[model samples]
Target: MSHPAAELIARSNRLGSDARNTNYAGGNTSAAGTETDPVTGQDVELLWVKGSGGDLGTLRQEGLAVLRLDRMRALVDVYPGVEREDEMVEAFDYCLHGKGGAAPSIDTAMHGLVDAAHVDHLHPDSGIALATAADGAALTRECFGDRVVWVPWRRPGFQLGLDIAEIKQQNPQAIGCVLGGHGITAWGATSAECEENSLMIIRTAEQFIAARTAELEAQGTHPFGPIRDEYAALPEAERRAKAAALAPVIRGLASTDAPQLGHFTDSEVVLDFLAREKLAPLAELGTSCPDHFLRTKVKPLVVDLPADAPVEEVVARLTELHQAYREDYAAYYERHATPDSPALRGADPAIVLVPGVGMFSFGRTKQTARVAGEFYINAINVMRGAEAISTYTPIEESEKFRIEYWALEEAKLQRMPRPKPLATRVALVTGGASGIGKATAERLAAEGACVVVADLDLGKAQAVAEELGGADVAIGVQTDVTSEAQVQEAIAAAALAFGGVDLVVNNAGLSLSKSLLETTVKDWDLQHEVMARGSFLVAREAARVMIAQGLGGDIIYISSKNSVFAGPNNIAYSATKADQAHQVRLLAAELGEHGIRVNGINPDGVVRGSGIFAGGWGAQRAKVYGVDESELGQYYAGRTLLKKEVLPEHVAAAVFALTGPDLVQTTGLHVPVDSGVAAAFLR
Candidate 1:
């Protein structure tokens, strides 16, 4: 790349793409290069730095903050002392080359004040493990032998940047240094050399941690303490089964302030950490790196109970633990808050740990939740290394609280875009691969709900899910709703993928238009089994999840007009529809106390884009109505009060309307989306 900004981006992506180098949006890179001044036509030095909140792994030109090196470095002349360092961030805007590029971050000063042409600030877990050690400064001296210096713990700001600059000037041979209780920063004469230095720091830290761990193991004094037999991970199937059961309960508890989407992990890193005897005390001390703290909160909610205990006992204990966690979090806020500090944003732990189960992380979106989990894994790595090398010692709680409640961070949070109507909600749609089910999946995904498209056709279901937005926003699960086990599996899949089910759409069905004389016993059983029994199975399983969540929920049944209207030659299908209609009433009355709203949509002959119609059911219905198959939709439209065909999208819209913010109080009510069919209207 000819431009300095492009070069910085290339360098940043190379460094940030690897988890060992840095995590998502957790590092900053800058390049000091010459660029011609637009107004003066003279060569001037410029600083191209990774901006605040931009992920270096996927960074673009717009994600870099371009600053006039002369102007940015000049801020030090009048540098307010460490007490007034936050004011320096605002000063950075005045040093910008133009009113473009991403906003400068807190580390801008660290990069600009340094004399090197290339600089990188990163939070590699291995590097941070050494940084948070009790003897970090002495350890840094021993590790690099003066080749890399150590900067003692200081909250990152302009002053910290100045301190690094002074250290660099004094030590000409140093390639980089570990920021005590923070991360690492490296500098070089060129971009390649800077990247090499960054990688060397990371690799060296990893090697040191590994060798030290082995040494400790040889001495029979490993960092995490002996593996507790009682805390050993359960079998994979049993562990995940327990996770699925506990997900809803954890999600509901975490959603006390605002509803949160969740992500679960049983990776070896997590399982190993949880299986150790020292897990509780180490977790309570909290993570060291600022990046880890931001995503994972100050500490986690550790489930201090037996992993193999009965589900009921475990659940009851979780409730007590959850209450204690909230109270402690509120106390932390109260102790640290100034009059101007933002109100306590939340009282829930973003990370939750269960011995023998794994980790659960919650956030406003799937990406956030998943990233939070990833960061906690990084934290585990950090804690392990710190314990192996020296006693793990994080920054003081006061310093952590100050940074956590920093006004600048609050402003960033406030600036985030408003969430969509169904944000943080997860939905499972049966038969979601096509027809009204497919339409509902798309609509819910568009409204910001994580969707699970469950259908018998796995390929089509996966395709629909991909179209909605892959694994992050949606996923596909092959399910035969008629089978109780399959229905349970589908619900479990949704719980595993995105915490718990907040809404479920029972739209999987097949119609058989046969006269009583023509319909055989086999045909009758199949229709009732797929439609009536299937809906019951799905509802029952989803209700278990919903009740466990204690967050209340929505279960919508796509019952048909045939449920109330007597359509000819439709015996089994019509009877199944009637069964579904009454189920809404029964479930609504029963589940109302749990805050679950059961509703139904009666759409009259949604022939266009419907799986039921495409699979030859339309031809049979057309023969009975005495109309050609091609004109069946028109025929159905003509019978309605309003001469408009009822398409699958109309039914999809009814499902959203019932579950969305607008109809929170409406339940056991069937909304007709058949373009005003008078005969099918509820009486």
Candidate 2:
């Protein structure tokens, strides 16, 4: 009673979950089955393949596009000569088995041509290492012997499908075909057989590379070295500063025709590859396979890292380097493009490599940018594997051009869904380990912004980040906002990990419940130092980075209702809150011309998860109110007209509204998030 398509979905998910097998929607799987047509009351043959832009790991029934096999097979003869990509697409569109289904993958023709019940096509790193080498066909023959078919590079379309079908017919015993400069296709009567064969081929390649790497290492010639050692040797602050300075430069340079989202990586593998003496040549050999053209482009831009230079000087030098890279890309496109090729897109580099710092990947969305980063890391391994065995050889320039400019490939990008409102933007939250800060960070990330959690407790900050999301969308930085140096470093870390600072939530504060006459100078100074001085430093540094990016941003300070309605015996906390509120207005006036909006949130009785309640201030205030500590939260909630307890989430909502598009034109405003505080309402 098991469905054939279910097996394909399960096996596809298994392959997609492993990065060694594929990276971000790069691989696909399909199955053939017979189903009774409800309308026609007749049995029909169908091909269920992964739909366009669907992730196989999370794929479901709806994610598969069902096509009529007979109708699809008929199109093989319709385009007898060089296949017209557009006409072929139209043919597939008309061959859909049902009225409503996901768009079929561009490889639908290739999948239908295989005479098997199950098929899996994947772009594994090990497979790509062999597919792109000059002697790739010979290597394929050696690994799988006669069981594999070797197809020369062809643009992936009708012609490619025809060639594959011809090869299968010529050698009926072959289990799979390794497409030159493309990927591997393994098919069998069952999904298990297909998966086993594919993994076997991949394992064989991995063993070959390991033996070759060991042999090369014995000769004292390494393809890559431990550049992470060099990176780790530098002071942590210096490392962050360099990465921050370099990320914006690379981002600005890569944005030739449009703004790009850049992220820095210093993983051991990435740094090791960057540290090579002849890295420029190795990096310029182009992508390892044709499928990667859309993600990594043809080649990455390599620029020198002036770690000690001022940011302005570094930006100037990088600008010149990027200009040259753009010109070179344009020339490369012109040399290989045919008369009928699609019009060229802009010449922005998708990846940027800095020797002393790290690698940076650029894209329109954070997901795309992260994928580019992943592909580059995989490319390094593929190239290394090739060099260890023989010489590193990539696909020819002309073939790379065909794939990069293919109309079918371009359509994939065009079909991508629109990004979320805060997509590609970065946010920083101080004291984000708990309380309102933690809530704000989570909210921003949910809206599609990369968040940086900065707190004095590094472990707590890191834990909070992990809970919200991993390092991809959220990172943790240990920061003492009271220290200027720490504040600057924290901002740099945010900029380095993400592209730049687009939004900042200044929420780090402390409360002391001593009477004005009994409060010591230390208590007063401590409150002012953290609330007033800390806010000033974080805002100043964040503004610098925002101005440098030439993008307007949002800055929100977590002030308190005490700023307007000071209770007896709370002078230190009340005075500091009032000072910060005034500072917000001043900052708003100064930063408005630069597109920066400064705002403040004043909340009352936010006892849950708040440091003021957790740190015994609530107990002291409860005593003054002649109530137990447990009753203080309810007492304050009841004081508001709404009689609703204002939790940390409520304050976070206010912060989002001010920073989001709804208040794009509003600034220098103090929003109340205290469940309708009557006395503290803004005039």
Candidate 3:
């Protein structure tokens, strides 16, 4: 058996080598991003794209061009057909080059043609193999079916774009298209999805090619002779060290995620392939799939020298290749692009596969890198199988352009709007020292609502405020929401600190474990004073502030699930919480005319390593359940569908959702943040 890591390393090598094969120097893979398309310009607030001559592996924000989205879409309807290509190309060139040295990719027209939020186009061994095969189109169609569309081989450039335009009109949902003798193109609502789709296609194709090749081997003598072992021929130390150096990079790229990373090349099949003079043809076919383009590009890097090449030297060569690749991308943009107005959706490849070294995926965030990495691993296996066949096929350049630039495809590119649901709104949360109150305070902070955390426990409140990250945005105030004087002082302080209050969360409460019959009147009075009466006092002050500010605000009450479902105990706590929930609905009804939104969160056991719960709740609950503290934790964990403890974060998320834009039309709703504890209550 072959180690998957070695196999991945070898296959990745082939993919990178293949990319360099097209223009041995490197290929252009960026977009001209200047000018001002009327449609894309109006639609998007900011469309950042990579600059020409910059490698995606080490790309930065400065390397990108920012553009509006709406302005570009408007051009699609007015501009159609082959003659428009030059105008489009010129438009891209004007904006991209006008900004000085930035260049666009050869595939700029394609990105301009798609409506995808993000797009990726690359030529890989699998794509090329399929493209060059006599039955490549049929094979791709048979394997991918409706998941992808196949285009007859055509020379890259303008006319191919027209063909893709026609095809995309027929299949609106086609993620990408395959060109008979070219590479692949994929698109999605976001870069993550696009990268995933590309890699998925490669994985699917690898399976198909492997199945077919195995059947052929059973029927006749294998075209490629028996496999051999080269890694075994090396010293044990060399093999171990190679595996050690390659694992993290491979793991990062996911070309092959073996248990120990060193297992990739342990397979006999992988060793034989790497030991070959030239990767011998196995059958007649293409590369893995179309999507591997963004990860592996169209080719792999090949080193004819010793296995122990200097790391620095190898890296330098890779760097030069990337630089040349950038130049090629720029030249391509110069020839094929017009106005650099629209944001380039799929011009540059996001990741690069270096044959002997490893794979590198570029992204601004870790998520972006991981998504690209996963695709590269899938591409490696698919490329191996494609090598056994003929060569990989790349999608026609024109078709790739259409998908990359389609308006509908680009619509998916918009990011989820930021969580500033209540812009310029101010909030004050009481009992914000720990648990639900603290959760609610943080939630409002995230929603772009300035918050003041008020609590009797000043230290805890201050700590929570500091963790929220901005002194300008949040503050900790000491006050008893139940005390009229203290409530007034806190409200006054908040007004001075953040101008005026726009939202108030009445979340202070006391929990008593006494049974209903055994409970003292003192317990009842204490609970009501803090939970129910305190809410009324705080709300009164908040309401006065709102009326004075002339901008009505929201009031959210953090109640308890015990208010709805009864246990044998918890009489006083239940009564007060019940009042809090009712108060929110009543307040919402009365405050509607003032433009205020009132809501409540009823949560249970918002456990965390905080002062309140860590004090005794865990221990007491454990004793009640006849289990140790750890066992009690496990009991709660098993009760939820997600099989996780109810953290303060979970409750905070609920509060955020309520205060967020998704609930603009919603008010007076009680969101249960108990991880299905309510469901359990119903059952």
Candidate 4:
């Protein structure tokens, strides 16, 4: 016998994996099957419906809310009507089948009340286009004839489920229904039939939209009206540069309430939409789908500037538009909010659209931001099709406000896990593929910061980035710190990857253990170029972005004990270290006004996992001390006040400390990680 549970899982994955069938975590599926009762030792009818807060594409047995089918249907007896329908969600616990504790979703009532053995509820863009059309009821009749029925909009709850059940009974021949101002729902006697009916409805609607769009093109017309050249996308490189430059400003404004990470996309769909004449007016109407608006906010802030506008001009207008958007959001909350409503969430816009530039979406994490951008793209597709056929109409603003501020939604937000200390921050570490740089990247990533690993070797940097978490939380950039262009590119990469730079680790350097007589001009310049000049370039470029973001940042330098103490046969290296040490103080004094903190770490001998040491410097130092290469760490430790050998992780921990909250107010300072080199103490 075929297992209904296994069949249901396969069907859901098939539909949910495709973006056209449903959005991430936006739909639910259910299977009515027989489960062997744990206590009664008898077969019992059960409904395996998707649990709350789960993506259908990745649904598993643990994410299914198992309930007694008979008990779930019994909820109608005390539903208390649509006004008090939210109460039914709490009542679902009583319907759970023996320890079925996956937390039933609000749609549980819908799956149980329906007479079919299998059902699917999805928010496909094509189906929603017809549903949100002014003539959606007529459109449904035209598309599916009597096969699919049209049901008026009603929020999902016990009442809506009862309504759908009534519709199904009245229209015996109906295979599915077009939900007004929503999406679609389909049901069948088996999982296979139900999956077919769902796909059939989606495909018919898509064909209908495509045919209508073709008709418009035949008549020299467009759903979005004429395309504007001034709003067209710039060349890829130029647009990316613009996005990199403006992301920090938009992110800072978006972070008014809490820090936010950003994602930028200038895809063809986004560019084409921006070039349309209806871009402004249609955008002002806002998204119609609950899932889309929940992530994108009710509406986006449209930057009304030509694609090639000057950065200075764009910034001035963005500042004015951001403040206006906040005021508008505050008013919107006040207009519909009830005394019983949850407190106003942030008034900041989650999505910002710039003509000719692209879209910048903000969220507390990179994944959320990227998803928000995707949801808006879906909304755009829906609007285009709706306009091609009939006038596009969304749910009322008052209704949208109710859903946006629903108490249930507020509770979901409250249940979110606490973020890591550096969760919203982004850090860039130079020479991050090896040694102290790699250790710092790992440490910061562990603390929840998005890391940008920069090194001359792209492969090594990429490997370290992949180990850190790939593009979601970390990325690698091939950067030769000595070059001004590469330094600029690396900073731009950080801005593009994660909103802006919050912390910078200037750890790129080389060592040359040579006395004054042995040191040549070439030796001195190489050390100074990588350590002194390189640190300056990275710091200067990062500070520019930090100031642009207006979010205060940290810049750390990995200097050495030799920077202060007179260590023998280390003239070239010591001179460059001294230059880096002073740059920390100089940059601190200059950049303090912008809230940029600059600090340094002076370590004695980090032998293990030290790139400088492995590059022949360790043996040279060991020779100078008359000790074997393996005993150099011991030699360096015995000379210190405390006989403790320093390692790369020790330097990494110090980097965390200086950037973390404990020393937020301390800057222009150097922390010695040399175990205890009393002679290297700051005066």
lDDT of 3 by residue, 52-91 (tens): 4344444444544443334443455555565445455445
Q: Encode model 2's per-residue lDDT on 1-683: one tens digit a residue.
A: 57878988899999888887776788788989999999999999999999887787888889898999998998866775674555787688888987636788777878898788888888888887777767888888887788887898776777777788788888988888888777788888888898987787778878877887898788887865434333222344665667786675566556657766777777877766776765778888878576576788989987665335565676777788788988999999889888877777889899887665677898876667878888888888788877766667787888788778877776776777777677878899999998899999988888878899999989999998998778778889999999999998888777777777889999999888989898999999999999999999999999988887777789999998988986888999999999999999999999999999999999996888887688988988988888989888899988888898889999888988998768899999999888887778787
lDDT of 4 at 371: 88
Question: Of models 3 and 4, which has the larger TM-score?
Answer: 4
State in Å the error of residue 45, model 4: 1.7
Identify the leading candidate in terms of TM-score.
Answer: 1
Instruction: Quote each prediction's TM-score.
Output: 0.98, 0.88, 0.39, 0.97
> What CA RMSD would you report for each candidate?
1.4, 3.7, 22.1, 1.6
Alpha-carbon runs more than 4 Å astray in model 4: none
Model 4: per-residue lDDT, tens digit, 1-683? 67887888889889999999998888899999998897999999999898888788988878888899888887777778888988888899989997794899888877899889999999999999998999999999999999999998887778878988899999989899988888899999999899999999999999999999999999999999988999999999999999999999999999998899998888998999998999999999998888889999999999999999998999999999999999999999999999999988899999999988899999998888888999999999999989998988988899899889987788888989999878889999999999999999999999889999999999999999999988988999999999999999998998888878999999998887888999999999999999999999999999999999999999999999989999889999999999999999999999999999999999888888888899999999998889999989889889988898888899999999999878899999999999888889888
- What's model 2's lDDT at 519? 91
- What local lDDT does model 3 show for residue 83? 42
Clashes (candidate 1): 0
Give per-residue CA lDDT, model 1, range 138-201, as digits (tens): 8888787888899999988899889999999999999999999999999999888998999999
Error of 1 at 147 (Å): 1.7
Off by over 4 Å in 3: 1-419, 639-643, 678-683
Error of 2 at 205 (Å): 3.0
Question: What lDDT would each prediction earn against the true structure?
Answer: 0.92, 0.82, 0.56, 0.91
